[model samples]
Each structure stands twice: as structure tokens, then as C-alpha cells.
Target: MDVLAVSIFVFFFLLVTILGFAAARWRRADNLDNLDEWGLGGRGFGTFIAWFLIGGDLYTAYTFIAVPATLYAGSVVGFFAVPYTIVVYPIIFLFLPRLWSVSHRHGYVTPADFVQGRYDSKPLALAVAVTGILATMPYIALQLVGIEVVLQVMGIGVDEGSWLVGHLPLFVAFGVLAAYTYSSGLRAPALIAFVKDILIYTVIIVAVIYLPAQLGGWDAIFSAAQGSFDAFNTENADAIAAGEVGAKGSIPPAAAHWAYASLAFGSALALFMYPHSVTGVLSTRSRSVIRRNAALLPAYSFLLGLLALLGFVAIAAGVTVAGDPPNPQLAVPQLFENEFPSWFAGVAFAAIAIGALVPAAIMSIAAANLWTRNIYKAFINQDATPKQEASQAKIVSLVVKFGALVFVLALSKSFAINLQLLGGLWVLQTLPAIVLGLYTRWFHRWALFGGWAVGMGWGTWLAYGVSSPTQAHFGGPLVPFPGTETNVYIGVVALLANLVVTVVLTVVLRAMGVDEGTDQTQESDYRADAGDEGVEEELDLTAPAHG
Candidate 1:
């Protein structure tokens, strides 16, 4: 073990764990007996806290590890992440304020809650809740992947004997995370985000600037990356011919342009649809906070752009893939291990591990809210009280985190990787019902459901048929663009299919006089903001904590 690195890592981790538990009282509510207090931090985070929380939550450790890993494993194509994030803020900026306004006015806790209120269809709300939960399972698992990668690079948890021994440290790390998250709820992540973001920015800024200079310069890095891609092409010619140009330059070739653009656009649309993303938005104090953060969050996208380039930086640093079977996720972490002192390496590792915790906490909370509000309360216990709901959410959040732990450990790492890819595809199917429905209720609720089914089916089928030299079927996100030999993002194709089905079925269903459910929302509600007069009074959390 790298004793110095491990010591520093433990110190920072224990500090964050302390902070996570203490956050329950940071902006302590009188009581924590409702979704508002527990699930959303009383829906009162200001602009400053919201910025760090949302930024930290969305740009997760999985992102930190995966974006560079993709770039390292492939090349230019992985850069779709950069453009996608750059465009996502603008897309969310256009609609999220309205969502924040209406949700606050109606006391909605999850995206599913808004769907149920807007469409007045419990089935549709359940669908949204289920989708959110399903998509989030793998996402939460991938966060653990980020932590595990760090642990492995630190020369710990490499035991090849029992699987339990191999992942014990990871379990211990998440055990602490799950504990504090259960105690503090949204506040845990919101408060811990401050330290996570500061460490991440420091590590990223120092690495990006200092590493390039140490490795010669940007020109050398680019040249080395190109040389590496050339070698990859020569070795994997068969893969390239099978529509998998696994390596390329900083700019995509003409043949791959559609794939790049569609991936970028599809990811942009799906970014805010994730339940965790919505949780972050709803925690803020006002609609203007949502809009201002939209403008400000691009700072993260800029940092992500820098992070993606680290893959190329790895190539220039002569960081070789080192394992029985090479793991590309190690590119950035390994680069640090090779170049930095053990203490700073520990700091970078702590940054990544904490990065994972913030998002995992938020995601588990979001999933739990979905379960409590849309599933348990909606069906299992319709008369559940505020205290009961909060209790159920806390219990469910713990279950979700442990479930994700099982998912990562029981399955192959390859399965975890593929699930992350599919998570976006599956979540994007909700756009018609959630995003577009926010503007116009033209969609028949059943039609939206039908569209969701078709999009999910078609996307999964196409993804199953895609093959590459490394793996058979479901190889990557790009598939053949309809009516052209070129590839496009499967999520976009699925989303387009989803939209088409919804449009066609809406016209038919309306013409045939099928019932369109009542919309519980109003135009004025969509315009409501903090301190709006007609907004419902928040549940009185002043009652003592009740089991």
C-alpha cells in the first residue's frame, strides 16, 4: 500500500464524513418529518449553496473518471461529453425555471410528482418514477466504480481471493456515506458539495496546467495522442471496419459527424431529466436561482473540457495501460500517481471519492423520494402522513444505496459500464411527458405512455444489435442514422421515435374522443416563485422527530 497516500486520503475522507453528519443541523429545520425537510433541504437553498450543490451533484466522480476514460479508450469521439454539457445549460435554462416555479407552488418532490400533478395520471407518474429509479441504479453504481478505481490506484483493495476482501474498503467507504446521507438527507450532499467542488477545482486546475508543462507542451500532447491513435488503428483495423473507429483525432472525421452531433444533442436533452438533476433544482429557494445557476453552471462544462483533455495528456505522459487487461478508467488517476507526490495524489483521490459521495447521496435521495411519493404513498399507503413519508424516504434511501452496492459487486464491471450507457437512453424517453408536457398538455397521457414504451423497446433492441471487435452487440451509443449509412446516437433516434409516436397517437386518440386526464396545474402556478402569495404553506416540520 502507498502508506502516505492512504493516510492523507483517510484524513480528508473522515473530515468529509464528519461534515456530512453535521450538515443535518447546518440549516437545521425544526423537525425532519416531511419530504421538504429531509428530501429537499426544506427547499430553501440559496444561490450560492445551490450552485455548488447542483454543480457537484451533476458533474460527478463517474464523470470525472469516465469522460477521460472514454477519451483514453477511444479518442475524439469521447469529446461529445464536452459539447453536450456546453449545450445542456442552455436547454435547461429555457424550461427549468418554469418547472421550479410550478413544483414549488404545488409542493412537488420528484419529477414523478410533477407528472402526476400536470397529467393527473397516477400510471404516468408511476412510469416516470420507475424510469428514474431504474436509470439511477447503474448511475449510483458507476459512482462506486470511480471510488474503486481510486482505491486500486492507491494500491489497496487488490486482493484476488474472496470478492468480499477485494471490495471491503469500498464497502466501508459507502457504509459511511450511506449513514450520513440517511441522517442528513439532501443537506448532507448540499453541504459536502462545498468541499468536493473546491478540491476538484484545485486538483483539476493544477493538473491541467502543471501536467502539460511538465510533459513538454500542448503540441507534444496532441502529437503523442495522434501517434497513439495511429497505432490503435493499425492494431484494430477489423474494429474500425465494423463501424467502430475506436480511435481518432481531436476532431471527428466527416463520417462520424452525425454520431458526434446527435450524441451531444441527445445527452443535452437528457441531462436535466435525471431525477437527481431535478432534486438539485427543486432544492433551490427560487426560480431566479434556477436561471442564474443555468448561466453559471457552464463553469463546470469548461472544467470538464479540461478534464477530457487529460486523456490525451496521459498519452503524452507515457502513462501506459497497466493491468492483465488494461482499464482505461485509470488514465487520469494513474497519471496523477505517476507524476505527483504521494500526498497530493491522495488529495486527488479524495477529490474523486468525495465527488462520488455527493452524487450518490443526492441520487439515492431522489430515488427514495420517487418511491415514497409516487409508489409507496400513491399506491401502498395513500393516507401516509408527512412524518411517515419522511421516514419511508429515509429507509428507502438506505435501501437504494445498498442495492446499488449489490448491483456493482454482483455484476461484471462491463455490465456496470453498459448500464451507464443505457441509463441515458432510458431516461430520455420521459421528455415527452415531463419536459414538453410542461409547456403544452397536447399529449394524451396514454399516448405519452405508449411513446415511452416504444422508445425504450426500439432503443434497447438497436443497442442490442450493435457489435464491435471488443464486444458483441450493445458496443457503443452510436447506431446507423435512419435512411443513411452514417451513425447517430441511439438515444436521439429513440427520442425522435418517442416524439413521433406521441404526436400520431395524440391526434388519433383525440379524434376518437379518448379521455385526456385533467391537468391539476395552472398557468399562474408555472409562473410562481419564492414568496408567491398563493403557494401552499410548507408542512410544519416543527413537530418533534417522529418515527
Candidate 2:
């Protein structure tokens, strides 16, 4: 290991941990025994804090490493992340403000909480909560994959025989994270996001400019990447023809257009559906904060596009996979290692590691909120106090983080990307219930539940059957588009089936006079904003911590 690099990384990592612990005092909630204080940071973030927090939460460590890695290994197909993020802000712009408003009005801590209030169906709310927790697990695992790539590139914990020994650094990092998060709650991630974003923006900007020059230039990088992809495609031409695998390059062939479009669109729809994404929005002080960030958040998408190109830069730098099975996830970190001095490489590594921590914290908190409010409070104890709820969430948050770590340690790292895609597929099934339900209550609650079931079942089945040249199953995101020769994202196909099922079921159940659950929400509730009476308390950031 480069001692200088490790030292620099450890310094930043510890610094962030310090900030995480200090965050509990940063906002200084009068009471820490409630969901708003712990889970949503008192729901008092202004535009500036909300911008960094939401941006940091959504553009996670997974994107920093995995996007470039996929581009490096698979080519044009990986660029789908760019378009997906680009389109997401606009779609959420239309609906997230509504969600924020309604959630605020009801003091809802999770999307499932909103579902319960809106549909008045405990069972439907349970489905949303369960799906949120399940989808977040793999996403959290991908964050571990990001940190692991960074550690491997830094030459730390390189070749320990035992799995536990090999992942000691990861466990240490996660332990620090869990401690801070338990103490500071959502404030931890919100505070550390400032540092994480600054480092990431600095590292990405420097690497994109400096790395290309250090090798040749963008032209040379593209040429090298194209040549590598050409050779790869030639070697795997049969697989490509049979739709078993995709070719690697900056641009895809004509046959991949549908897959590209569908993946991008489906991912856009899924982005805001994830409970963590909604948690970020809900944590803001006002509906306007969500709206303004919707416009400003695209800045990260532009940065992500630049980050994705590092895969080509890796090709130009002659960076090769170091693992026995050849993990492409190492491409960006390895590229940094090859080009940068040890100290700066440590800064880059820290940026990626901290990036993972922010999202992981937010996801764990979101999942915990779902459990505490929808599952535990709803079923286990209706009389549970605010302190009990917060305590349960705190416990569940640690469990969620370590659960993700266990998943990564037990499974092949190759499954990280596929599992994240699986998370997207599963989370997207909630769109009709949450996103569409924002506008119309036409679909019965039972129908919404049926829709979720159909979407989840079909999506999982299709995802399981998808085979690549390397893996027999759970290979990639693309599956055969129903009723067409072209392939599309399985998420989209499942969503279509969900909508169809929901519509048909709604008509059948309505005509039969089946009981549609009561709606506990008012029409004006969806338009409520900050300062509205009965909304969660705002943070007293200027007040003394003990006041």
C-alpha cells in the first residue's frame, strides 16, 4: 500500500466521520425521539443544504465507480446512465413537489407512510414499505462495491486469504459510518455531503482534464477505446448477433437503440421511486426547494457524463483488470492509480468512499423509516411512542448497513451491477401507486397492490431469465421487449403489465362495488408547503445544542 495515499484517505475519512457525529448538534433538534428529527433532519433544509444533500444522496458512490467501469468494460450501453439521470429531474419536477407537499402535511417519514394516508390501506402500505427495503439492499451493496474497488486500487487489503481479513478495511469504514449515523441520524449524511460533493467535483474535474493530457488527448482516448471495442466485438460477434452480449464502445450499433432508450426511460421513472430519493426530497424545508433543485440537480448529470468518459481514459492509459475474473469495476480507480501521484490518488479514493457513505446512510435511514412507521408501528405496536419509533429506526439502520455489507461479502462482486439493476426493476413497480396516485385516485388500493405484485413478479422472472455470454442468468438489464423483436428494459415491460393490471382490476372491482379503502388525505393536502400548520417542526440551527 502507498502509505501516503492511505494516510490522506484516512484523514479525509476520519474528518467526515467527525462531521457526521457533529451533525446531531449542527441542526440541534429540540427533541431526538421522533422520525422528523432523526429520519428527516427535522425537514428544515433550505435550498443550499437540500441541493447538496439530495445531489449527494442520489449521485452515489456506485455511480462514481460503476458508471465508468461499465463504460470501460461494455462501452455505449453504459452511457445509458447519463440519459437516465438527465430525464429524471424533469419527471420528478412534475411530481416530487406534490409528494413533498403531501408528505410534509401528514408528517410522513417514508413513502409507505404517504401510501397509507392516501390509500387508507395498511396492506398496500406494507407492500410499498417491503419493496422499498428490499430494493435498497442491493443498492447499498453496490456502495460497498465502490469502496472495495477503491481499497483494491489503493493497494490495501489486497490478498488476504480469508474473506473477513480481505474485507477488514471495508468493515472498519462501515463501522465508523454506522456509529456516526446512529448518533447524528440524517444530519450525518446531510453535513458530510458538503465535503463529499466538493471532493468529488474537484477530483472529477481534475482527472478529466489532467488524465487525458497525461496520456494523449480525448481524440487518442476515443481511438483506443474504439479499437478495443472493435476487437472485443469481433471476438464476440456471435454473442452480439445472438443478443447474448453487447459490444463495447462509445456508440452502440443500430440494434441496441431500443435497449438504450428503454433503459434510459425506465431508469428515469425508477429514480424518484426509490424511497431514498423521495426521502431526500421530503427532508427539504419547502416545495420550492424541491423545484429549484430539480433545475439545479442536472449539473450532476453533466458531471456524471464526464465521469463516464473516464472508461475511455482508462483504455487510453492501458489500464488492465487486476482480478482473476477481471472486474471492470476497478477501471476508474485503477486509472487514477496509474496516472496520479499517491497523495492525490488518495484524495480521489476518499471522494469515492465518502460518496458511498452518503447514499448508504440515506438509504438505511429511508429503509428504517419504512420499517418503524409502516411495519413496526402499524402492526407491531400502534401505541409505540416517538422515542420507541426513533430507537427502532436507529437499530434498523445499522442492521440495514451491515446487511448490505454481508450481501457484498457473500456474493461475487460481479453481481453488484446486476443487483443494482434489479433494485431499479423492483423499485420501478411502485411508480403507478406513488407517482400516478399523486394525480388520480382512480386505481383502487387493491388494484394498486395487484399492479405492484404483477410488476414485481414479471420483472423478477424476466430478470432471472436474462442470460449473457458470461452468465447463464441475472446477466444484464435488457430483456426481450414483449411483442417485438427488439429488446427493452425489463422494468418498462413490467411497468406496462402493472398499469394494465391496475386498470383492468380497478374497473372490475369498481363495477362489482368492492370496497375501495378510505382516502385519509385532503385535496388541499397535496398543495401544502413550508410553514403550514401541523407540518413537522423546522430545525433551530442557530440555537444552542442544549437549548
Report lDDT per candidate: 0.89, 0.89
| Clashing residue pairs in candidate 2 (N, C-alpha, C atoms within 3 angstroms) | 75-249
Q: What TM-score goes with each of the models?
A: 0.96, 0.97
Tens-place lDDT per residue, model 1, 254-287, is 9888888999999999989999999999988788
Query: Which RMSD does model 1 reach against the true structure?
Result: 2.5
Best by TM-score: 2
Q: In candidate 1, what residue range of length 10 has the lowest lDDT sum? A: 538-547
Candidate 2 stretches greater than 4 Å from native: 235-245, 540-547
lDDT of 2 by residue, 1-547 (tens): 8899899999999999899999988868777788888999888888899999999999999898878987888667889999989998889889999988888888788888888988899999999999999999889888888898889888886577876777789889889889998999999999999999999999999999998888788998888988888899899999888887766777767988998999999999998889999888888888888899999999999999999999888888999988766888889988888789999999999999999999999999999999999999999999999999999999999999989988888888767667778889999998888988899888999999999999999999999998877898898888888778898999999999999999999999999999998888888988888767766447644565522
